[model samples]
Target: MGIGGGVFLGPVLLLIGFASPKNIAGICSAFVLVNSVVGLLSHSLQGRVDLSVLFFLGLVVFAGAQVGSFLGTRKFSPLLLQRIFAFILLAVSLKLGIGISG
Candidate 1:
């Protein structure tokens, strides 16, 4: 699965230079969470959701989000977080470019 919000939000948020990497990450996470909820609801209303997969995936993502939040807030430095975001943006761009080319 792909990261939904970061591709659009990350670069712009970084460019805006929020108070801290932690704050930026938190904002992105909030956006993504809201986006996911809305998507899930819309798909579910349309009778497109797979309950089994959603249950399993939700559990995994919940755990992952917790860990990532902890790490982003506690373990990584601001500079390191910035670099990580940059790298992720670069990687996503390259992947999209390659996919389009192919």
Candidate 2:
């Protein structure tokens, strides 16, 4: 019933609440970790697991996440990070919209 927490929660928490960006990032990180675990388990139980592809993709995603989290949380100002996040969301939305239309 409540807002599903993930990428959207970070910005909402930062803008509408009193939490710092770093704290919001930490909370979002935990949500991502838990969601990933649950998703993996559900897929595996459904007999849709692909260990080989998951292994390679997980490695790439893990490396990127580490670097991204470090820079996003520690190096950038909150306003700059919010701008970057909005830009990314806009780009992804446009890409999906174009894909859906075409």
TM-score of each: 0.84, 0.71
**lDDT scores of the candidates, listed in order:** 0.81, 0.77
lDDT by residue (36-96, candidate 2, tens digit) is 8888898899999888799899999899999988898678998987677678667756866
TM-score of 1: 0.84
Candidate 2: C-alpha lDDT:
0.77
Instruction: Report the lDDT of model 2 for residue 83.
Output: 79
Candidate 1: deviation at residue 25, Å?
Answer: 0.8
The top-ranked prediction according to lDDT is 1
lDDT score, residue 25, model 1? 79
Cα lDDT of model 1 by residue, 10-98, tens digit: 67876787557678778888898888888889889999999979889989998999999898888989889989988987887998888
Which residue runs of candidate 2 sit more than 4 Å off their true CA positions? 1-4, 91-102
Return the lDDT, model 1, position 4: 65
